[model samples]
Target: MTEREPDSPVAEPATALGRMTPVDLSHPLEPGMTVWPGHPRFEHELLQCYTRGDASRHHRIALGEHTGTHLDAPVRFVPGGADIARTPLRALTGRAAVLRGPAGDTEVTPAALAEFEAAYGPVRPGDFALVDCGWAGRWNTSASLEPWPYVSVELAAALLEREVRMFAVDTPSPDPSDSRACPVHRLLLGADALIGENFTHIDRLTG
Candidate 1:
């Protein structure tokens, strides 16, 4: 038998010799789907259907770029920043951790992140640190449209210091609803980290 080289690529098994299951993290799109306030709602129209005696079916959809469970590119806030197409894949995936918080918390504070790190482990560089405030359950409700948990500026700065590649939350925006300045968005975007907003089912993430 030949010895395997140390530098050779080894296939890492994702499961223990069993069928792997795929978890869906994206929200399905449909007509009248929930969206940010003032943003255009999604609409689905059947261009051609089997019932119409057509050979195939087709649909026409219209929605905003920042619609449900979407990633926000730097260009969203930064002038001349990278667009959605220009965003790197590594920035969106790879090692990620969800920092859980108490229900009804208005903002993710630096202390909460520290506590999470102490319980779990320190977040390494180039990792995606997500804030799970149990707000995803409020999707499509009036409370979701109102002010919900968001990332504080101090927390954004802390995450920057941790060198996180992305900051994700389960809310419409990382900043509060009433705030006009939106410092959290500017700070994270200017630091070259992407943002994921309006995520659903984040609480279901487990080891």
Candidate 2:
């Protein structure tokens, strides 16, 4: 088990005059939810059910850490990096920018990221930079498992230059599926930056 710090207090989101517009960025996790190949699939079993004459209901759930909409900590790729328990919550909560890529591409390059900046200003420090590659539409299908959009090492370097709080993607892994060396994961997470993967509904945020 990893040694962890005490839980920190989390502040509630600010509502405008008690009204809040919430955007759900996560995919629902079910018994048959899609998972990365070679990873255990999500499973759920009922421990107690009202239909079975039980007064209350409960369930036993099992899933990998990377299942569904999830965040990856530095410990995922870097030695001696912060684990989920040690990662600060504030790093995952902040202003987020949705960067759209050109249609029909499997790789987001440094030049595309530069184009994004040219249009929406530089990705400011402390922002969550989400790359939208139109891949979320392929969620849960075999096609999603195919070579999906991923960030190039150069783009990873540029994102690191911006000191982003978190980097998010709509695919399973930001690095190539067959990569023996995951340089992007190491570069970002090793710097204590967070990573959100398998994100859905990112296209809804893109202009």
Best candidate (score: TM-score): 1
- Residue pairs clashing, model 1: none
Query: In candidate 2, what are the lDDT values of residues 16-48, reduced to their tens digit?
Result: 424745678888998877788788989898999
After superposition, which runs of candidate 2 have C-alpha atoms over 4 Å from their true positions? 1-20, 103-105
Q: Please give the TM-score that candidate 2 achieves against the real structure.
A: 0.86
Write the residue-wise lDDT of candidate 1 on 82-166 in tens digits: 8879876656667677787566747788977788788778888888887788888888777887777778899899889989978
Evaluated against the true structure, the overall lDDT of model 1 is 0.81
Worst 10 residues of 1 by lDDT: 14-23
Q: What is the lDDT of residue 98 in candidate 2?
A: 81
